[model samples]
Target: MSGTSEGPTPATDLIQPNVTHSDATPCPGTEQIAVPAAGQTAAAAPSAPSRGGPDAPLPATGGTTPMAESAPAPAGFTGMDQQPSAAPRRPPAEPPFRSAFSAAPLAMAVVDRDGLVVSANDTFGALFGGGPEEFTGQVAADLVDLTSDPRIRQAYQQVLDGRRARLRCARRLKHPDGHPLWVQITVAPLAPESPNVLLSVADISARRELQDRLRHVQNHDPVTRLPNRTLFFERLSAALEAESYESGGSGRVGLCYLDLDGFKAVNDTLGHRVGDRLLAAVADRLTRCANEAGHGRTSVPLVARLGGDEFALLVEGSTGTEQLAELAESVLTALQAPFEISGRQLSVSASIGVVERQAAGTSATALMQAADTTLYWAKADGKARWTLFDPERNAHRMTRQALVSSLRTAVDRGEFTLEYQPLVGMDDGRLRGVEALVRWRHPRFGTLTPNRFIALAEEDGSIVPLGRWILATACRQARRWQLDHPDEPPIFVSVNVAVRQVWDSDLVADVAGVLAETGLAPHLLQLELTESAVMGSAGRPLQSLRALSDMGVRIAIDDFGTGYSNLAYLSRLPVSALKLDGSFVRGFQHEENTGENAAGQGEEHDGAAGRPSPADEVIVEAMVQLAHRLGLTVTAECVETCDQASRLRRIGCDTGQGWLYSRPVPPDRISELLGSRC
Candidate 1:
């Protein structure tokens, strides 16, 4: 009643009733009514009940006696006759409504249209640090911070205007003790015609605190406290979506995929505890680097730990590759210093792959893939560096992988073939031997050369078996040629050997078995090894070569001058021939004064005028002499011109191999050459 209308409308004007008597009660033919308070208008008052002469024993129309209308009215009650009661009725005992309002658990308050508190329950008063009497008449808006939020104010207004029956929101309340009180406030009109609102508040601070902790745990890494991969990917997706809207899909995005070099070694050698500490230190440094890099940018880069020994940075709206390169450089420089953990100074480096592209055509998956591939490239190109994404390089790598995957089966499928290149005597121009070059007659990429798949086989250890196959095939072919030309000098067949074959395979036994199976003389089957392989030969490798030499097999050092030309070391090995590298042969044709000296050999003139810098010629002449003195034959490789051949002959070289004689041909072509020589 206190907040029914502005200034408290009189009790008579507040209650409006259309009263009806209940026939089920013991009050037949009698009217039960609520008499309006003082100052009621006659039109608003109920008609006076007709008196039936002391109610005529209260007519029993419904088998019940009616109350006499002449009964005395309670004190302070106004009857229909507008007569004062015989005695002023004592004020009604304390109502149940007041007891309920006082006992309500939630903080409850009644706010009038003027936003003033008309009545507040004890809970409301106690919650705000006061009693009900002290809170009464206070401006409700000033008592709490709800109106500070426009949304809460709008909700309040909506309820006040009757547009909404109830409105609720969660907001922080201003407290007298200056402590924050989070609460859920609900507003509802007290009644259909009431101008007052029933506002209720419930504390929710504890729930909110729990939710905040959960969110932190979900989005962060436990070890580093940095955002984990989940949060990083979420942010990356958001940034990409924002770029699509902000720049018409033209914004550039960049990512740096990083892996710690030799992280496994650290984990294995130092134990996981030390590895964990090192990982934490690395994470901290990465976070600092990302922050420093984004100093002046609108969107800060997000650094996250993808997993063990792996991390990434998402750069939104990147300027270009140069910017990404700078970021990568910073990361590398930061990790250059040693990390002291558990009293041990551990030095580590990282390889980063950077990828930047227009956000319009790229996706998170594709971007991450490119970055990962680039990172592998960095590791492959010798760790501790950064490599940019190159589509061409990726394609090439994919092709190499495809070839490697197919190589093991290629041998079983018999897709491999061989071509023979003649090694012609430099002086006589006759074939002394033929080099067997392996080729892959692939079903997809037709006829791949050995250079393409041989390294793949070596890396995967498939070369051991492939090398055995080649050795057997070459020996059998050479035996056939030898048997066909019984009356002619036997022509030898040289087969290249991979280093892995020498180390991983039983080279001595394989060669011996192949020679016995084919009945080909070991001397007529030459095995050529690159200079590095020959120079690095030691222990078992050296013993294998000596064993082959003892078996009457020819051992030649191919590509001789490119590696460590340790003459003293070379003379001690079981070597029979040296094939001069082609790079030196290309310089031969350019030299003047191609005249043969007095001994039918090139002149040993140093810096002769009009002679192409005798540097290469001088080196070749010296090598030929060295080989001859060691009782080893010297073959000039890549001899493509008559001048090159003549120079080699004058330099006292034994043989020449190049396109000038004939490109590498099939075994049938070699057989034809053999027949012609015969």
Candidate 2:
């Protein structure tokens, strides 16, 4: 490889320190070329034509000449004084695209099918803190962090094998100088059939940072600087999922759904600005509570503003219901303090619903619903308290809702039937009439009594249709009983009607139509209403009672003395009967322990096993006398024994209806008893 100093030298002898070649010599008939050192630019101007050759260009300045130009001729010194027949054949020109690839602005590298970096442009080498030659033969996958993610690695492999067109993904990288960088890496085949792939990387840190900022804004509350409903729900859902608990966590979640009591009043009277400030203040206290609750735990609870005056604290990996209860109590105690807003001392309280359970089968929606129901219970039980979610209570409410939803349908489906309790005349011990009671034969919840569904029906207006059904059925049955017993005076039927039946329906028309359709005398039918319903009667109710009374139908007050007993309406209204409540009759019992007073056990008792309370006797006697003086018959309820009946009969009560006569029975049972007296 050495060359003599007097003649043109071989290109290998003049190789620069920065440049190296794998081949020692050129191929047959080809000449070797020299490359410049690093950081030295090649002169762009064309060299002057040689004087000894046919306008041949000189070699680049400050670099070795080509082998053909440096070699000495076989003839004597052919130099600037000698002219040749033609220009010497120049070494084959370097590939034009290679230079462009090296100069491209984009950071790029060429990786062979073996996943080794065959070559990298200067820009790529600079980007990764290395020179171009230093990157050669390195694993391209490691250089770009493609192997960190299996999905990206797989796609990169596919692109390397020419099985896939291209692959692009984002990656976070740390530079050697301790700074973070986000880059988008792309890999694609250099050509359709090429064995090499070109990998390109672009800086995307600014874009990622912008996206993170936007996401934060979207997931946070502006006023509280805490998570909003969106983020709360997201975290709740994640916590409820089984996967969230698989990482050695507690596998339990808890939530405290909180609402500021009387918040709407504050907004209405003090304006929304003050209301908003109060809510923000509440949020701050809630956050503090969450932080304190999370002490000595793995993670702090998430506090979020659900909207307006409502906020929630979500605890993942919760210990149990006890932890949730403690958290809820903390919230209540924290909110008890007064908030100073707009120079006014504003006082507010919160009602919180606490729910906690295993995360395996729970959902965010179910948890929130339970919490909401418990919160309503807290408010109803009186505000400024915390209520834990009780599955039993929730089930009862759900059953009530199910009953309410099906109440109207139950009527149309004929799922209801009547049971009649006998009312016996105290004087003659003869059956005076039967009080009609309604029962629902629910398919799912069998045999529901009036106490269970009646109020629900009343609330939803289902009582109107249900009451009409009861009236018509009772009248028709009573007429059948009359025809069955021609010898016995027709025993009357008394049906209980809700107050809503009077206000919501034409009660007089319904009663008159039923009597005409059943061919039963109006005197044989009586409608009983609660004392509350009949006490302050006026308007449509007063008119309805007067009309029905004029038609010969009797009106009676049920559960007397249990409500506002305004007796003034008795002289003006058309009420013909009074059914005293069972509580009064319950106290009218013979004393089985007459000697208890001597034993120092004498105390005012409920007559459970003692002598009749004198107060009850006097009250019953006065009511019975007042009722008889007003021309209204008296009926005593809950008469359970002959002694009680004797006491009621002595009180001059006209009728007694209780277990002493018979428990409420079906229509057929009542028919069996119609021929006999109590």
Give a tens-digit lDDT track for model 1, residues 573-610: 99999999998887675334445542344454343332
Candidate 1, residue 597: lDDT: 45
lDDT leader = 2
Kindly report which residue stretches of model 1 are placed more than 4 angstroms away from their true locations once superposed: 1-212, 245-250, 259-285, 332-350, 379-384, 483-487, 590-611
Total clashing pairs for each candidate: 2, 1
Q: What value does the lDDT take at residue 107 in candidate 2?
A: 85
* lDDT, each prediction: 0.81, 0.83
Query: Each prediction's TM-score against the native?
Result: 0.67, 0.83
lDDT of 2 by residue, 370-439 (tens): 9999999999999899999999999999999999999998878989999999999898888989999999
The true-versus-predicted C-alpha distance at residue 507 of model 1, in Å, is: 2.1
CA lDDT for candidate 1: 0.81
